[model samples]
Target chain A: MTIASEPADGYAVRSRILNFLKYGANSNPADPRVPFYRHPIFVRVAHWTNVIVLTVMLMSGLQIFNAHSALYWGYQSDFNHPLLSMVAMQNDDGSLKGVTQIGPWQFDTTGWLGASQVNGQWAVRGFPAWATIPGPQWLALGRLWHFFFAWLFVANGAIFASLAVYRGHFRRDLKPKVSDITGLPAEIAHHAKLQFPKGEAAKTYNGIQRLTYFTVIFIIGPLIVLTGLTMSPTLDSAFPFLPWLFGGRQSARTIHFLCAFSFVLFFIVHIVMVVLSGTWNNVRAMITGTYEIEQAGGRHG
Target chain B: MADGATRRGFLMRSFAGVATLALAGCDSISQQPWLDPLLRSAEALTMRVQRLFAGNHALAQEFTKADIAPMFRANGTLDPGTQEYRAHAQKNFADWRITVSGLVEHPLSLSMDQLRKLPARTQITRHDCVEGWSCIGEWTGAPLAHILALAQPKDEARYAVFYCADPMSDSNGDGINDSDFYYESLDMVEATHPQTLLAYKLNGQDLDIAHGAPVRVRAERQLGYKQPKYVKDIVLVDSLDKISGGRGGYWEDQGYNWWGGI
Candidate 1:
């Protein structure tokens, strides 16, 4: 079925724009009333838990990455080809020069991603001190933080995923149907204009929402976890094929970094959407399992 | 009981265990009588999982000389400056002997010259340090497999512990000195690995003092800390529990993972 493509009726569009600008429009002249159970208790709990676990994992991961500020592809790093590197190259002079490089492009990332002074001494510490946990160049502590949070993240993900599957929450809600795929172009158009579904349409996730949720949960999460295991030398011996599957240990490390940044991207978009859409209502749905919708004819359901 | 109830119970118990461990802190919780068994079990689980994934004979990747780090900074204690080590170093280690004993049917003391005469294998491999830096270097030495074959470890032998002459202790406010010895151990699988070498030469030159002179055991598949330098003796054992700190290596004794494969 073709989406109207004529843009959501002007009244709905106008209300959405006003609501967005107002930071969540609850007072629609045409009050559409619907109290939908947007998020279940299990989903809400998992979401919040993941918020903490992922944040710690990301920061601690950066700490561990700082130990070796270079990334490459293949079983071993040749040092000749680095997919990404954040480090300071010593100049002819006594001073340290910070550089962040990807492929052939080099950027001076001093005091930020590459090198920065901590405790008034020059160090080759990568990713800067502020970005890492413990805020020092301690690999042991970094590993501890990373492994601890990693276990938590994996356990939480496993439980949430299994429940999501068994409960059909994924199928009934997040899954995109044939119509969603067909209507994607129109949906993209609406999204480009910062337009969101309202009333009945808001009850269900939009096409882009379903896709993003599915990708983050299924694709991004598993990729990071598996690639992480691939980098372990012990695991490499046990699962010798893991390195081959990912091209090599360094390749796995690079993929893990990329996957992490992908989550960061998802988080930014998620926050933006949460703020743009009715922040109060969206937050309420997550916390109390209740969502207020703007239905047509100023009616409340 | 319903599946949901069982799942809830499991989740709650897991969370409670995590909370207890966290509150106790790794050091204190490890000292706790009850948690010791649990933590050891967790460590065992990690080792088992890695062993299951990694093949016993799987060789670590070999690299070309071009991949070697321009400046491979010496890690850990660079100088094993014991009076005995200095005496041997003065004579170019001609008097040094590496004793292969314990749990072995044939105990042999091989000198540097004898070791040089043995069949040698040279491979360029990357050394992955637990501290996160890595360096590739060409190591030429007699295969550890051949040495173990000559020693003929008894049936009960399960581990090969390499004792180094490095004085790792910084006791009495002095810098790293040879008051304490450095040592590392490897399981039978690692000990007998084809790539495992008693490396005496690096980059076509004799091993320097900064590197482990006389001899260094290269357990290629493990982290650099597992590669002990200044080889003074090799003791085969049925178990590592009786060793100092009972964790397998000096670093492992200091709370590093026993399995330093990563």
Candidate 2:
């Protein structure tokens, strides 16, 4: 239901103002007697499982990236041209110098990104020591960690998708209607002002959140998985069109890296929003499947 | 917001719980003895999914001559330094024989020249190493299926194990009389794959010593390690469990997966 459908009650309006002032935490509510059953039990389980799966996948993926540290736009790479590379050249004085080159643009990324000191010795590595699984330059073990969690990630993702479709989670929650777009500008402005919807408005996701979740789940999620599979040598032949579809294997690799960063960006924003909105309330809703909605009278239910 | 004390307590406790779980995953304790089976189960799922994608007869991507790398690296074993391998190299492998035995109607011992006379196939394909490097090379060799036909593998033959001459690990620093010899195996589908070959030629020339001369396996669907170099024998077996280290290949015994697809 649209936010306009609400009764236009004085308590709801006052509650919205109070929520805007306090940064969306359930406080100073006028109608605080209603509790919303928000998150489903299955969604809660899958969400937490994804926290672990994505952690392992991203870390190990960084480890895998360290092995080649170069991205290209074609099937083969010969060091002649690269779309991007994380590497450091050795100097005459035995010092390591790292650089990240994207096309003609080159940035000296010493002590980070491409090059770092591991155990007091300068080494050319992707990401950093803290960012890789096994925390070493072992590609073999990195692959093991990557493939292991990849299994879990894909399986969990399959479950999440099936449930989202079959159980109407998408329709009930994430799916956006035509009306969601009409309020986009106002929603963004309210977000920029740190003002949040309260009372019945807070019971369900806002338009921005609905759009974000839809994009992440349907668009980015599938693209990332498909691009990931495109990197496999066996799958290249089995599904020949995949490599060609993405332009080539290296192109798929570049897309995979960019998608990973997008995930990281989404994660950072998600956590920050969670904390700002109401850490305990959000976390509790995800855990116990119940959420307390605030109203204008400075009370919570 | 009025129940701030209780909410704060729950939040703090949940944060601590999640932190503990995450840290536990990062630590070595995650590799406890009890967890290996679970990990293997997950690995099995990965194998099944990969196999489902890679049908039995699908050929790996073949490249043109122009796409061939300038230097197709001979990794893992540059030279099988044993006296027997050296003797074979000195004589240009004139006396070298590859024995195809076990679970076959006829145990055939074919000389290097005899193998070259069989119906051969030439294809340029990418050699993807497990270490993440790749090189394209034009390989000319007898199709493994044609060679297997001469031996007539029995009904029970499910896997073909390729024996190599390389002594992978020798504590004495002397390659001779080493206990660790390199070997790799493939299931029936990969073994009989059209691209699967006992390659005797590389880049329009005779196989060099650095390469798996006399012959090395070319299982195009798998990683480079599965294509064992310095081949000396092919044994058809019902399972890989009875082999050395009971894994499938030397690298598999050393912690790589038995299935080397992708």
Candidate 3:
């Protein structure tokens, strides 16, 4: 909610903070741009917390994955017939080389995937040192980081979902309407041409944005959590149907890995869109809960 | 135009620099004293949550004969290379005795034959390693509960600490790992599990050195590390503080979560 009767100094301080962040000259004081309330306080907090939690979960997860450095399907790991594996082999000259095998096909991926430089020495590892949490071959610390943040991540997601539903944030912003489906083609066309919505339409997300957010939050979120739980032995004993639902334990692990990469993919696209659309406007909205809705210019379709 | 390109290059370089700086900061922060306990608190949460749901009586999944892997991969210390272990192995573990003492009324020093004569349990169960691999094998051994019942653990007995024959290298001189023998512990719930056994056989055959021959523990619900190989002693202790590293297990001493269910 906007405090319409706010003191003059509040806007001045916010403006000063923005000026320090921005490199270019300040916007004209004579013609002030009206601010539109976009993200709520809850959304802002949840969003920022996720940025930290997700990063730790991903990096530490890679460290954990490095322990086995292989993926399989079905109940147990078929060591000989792994779906994917990272192995180190000695060459003819006695030089160690890293090879990644994916179901009969093998590729030399030294210095990155299968093996990488660690502490100025060529070490056999799945992911590079830079990618993992501890920057070393420490499974224990990695696990600690993962499990700790995993709880936080789940808690954040639960809170965000409950709040979104309770506050009508879902219905008002995220939930797709009949028009969202009907206008999908036009939205896709606009996105393809790098033409974001302008004027009244720019006040809220387009059909594409709504659909993507909906899928990521509702569908992908639950799927990842379920798949993660399926890997636990005690959980499997407690809920036998979990692994059964995902085919098996190993299959669940494979799906969990896929879901992690899906988030990465979404993150890449999300960042590109934020940068392309209006970096300052979007970032400032998340930070201060208000957006400067752009006007229809000559470039607007 | 040149200025725009230069500025773009500088921005990209600075981004990479920032990322490196952030990673370095993360690494340093991970070593902080407060952060470790903060992260480890999740271990307690996970253990409590899992145990609450899966009760003590719940059994780990059992497999059929077909599910057993052709070769159950042997990991960690495959051999207890000490002279005592070598001599014991030479006689097919005839001289080998499992000393079950501490926090018990009837302390036991049972030979292999005596342990074999006790209540035996055979089941095909999956051995899940902490490194993320699983192998199904039919294990035959004396149920730990049957032995615990005979020994009659004292009221203060809170954990069944396992002492193995395998000696680990104590390189770091961390007094906790100085008693280099690989060891693990289980709570009363896990210790008393029907499937928990002092496994003396794998696939209907006597345990070989490669597989913790003489005996190894088979705590089916826990990860492989929790099931220490090369059994030598079984000590019942109330608190883990007096033991090596005081974390309960050798790997736990190395900063692993003591709760291995996950």
Best by TM-score: 3
Residue lDDT tens for model 1, A164-272: 8889888977777888789889998988776767767888788999988988999999999999887776666557678789987778888999999999999998988
TM-score of chain A of 1: 0.87
Candidate 1 lDDT tens digits, B140-245? 9999989999999999999999998897886777664746688999989988999999999999999999999979988877888999999989999998998999
Candidate 2 backbone collisions, by pair = A28-A298, A29-A295, A29-A296, A29-A297, A29-A298, A30-A295, A30-A296, A30-A297
Best by lDDT: 3
lDDT of candidate 1 at residue A22, scale 0 to 100: 43
Q: Which tens-of-lDDT digit does each residue in A1-301 have in candidate 2? A: 1434667799767856655444454344344535678888889999999988898899888888898888777665556677788888887997888999989899999999789977687788978877887576876666777887887888898899899888888887789978889989999998877676777787778999999988887788888888888877778879989988987777787888898888899999998788667676778788999887766444443
The residue-by-residue lDDT of candidate 3 on B29-85, one tens digit each, is: 888899998998889899999999889988888889999899899999877787778
- Segments in model 2 whose C-alpha atoms lie over 4 Å from true places: A1-34, A91-95, A117-124, A178-183, A296-301, B1-25, B69-74, B81-87, B173-179, B209-211
Q: Flag the better candidate by lDDT, 2 or 3.
A: 3
Clashing pairs in 3: B176-B245
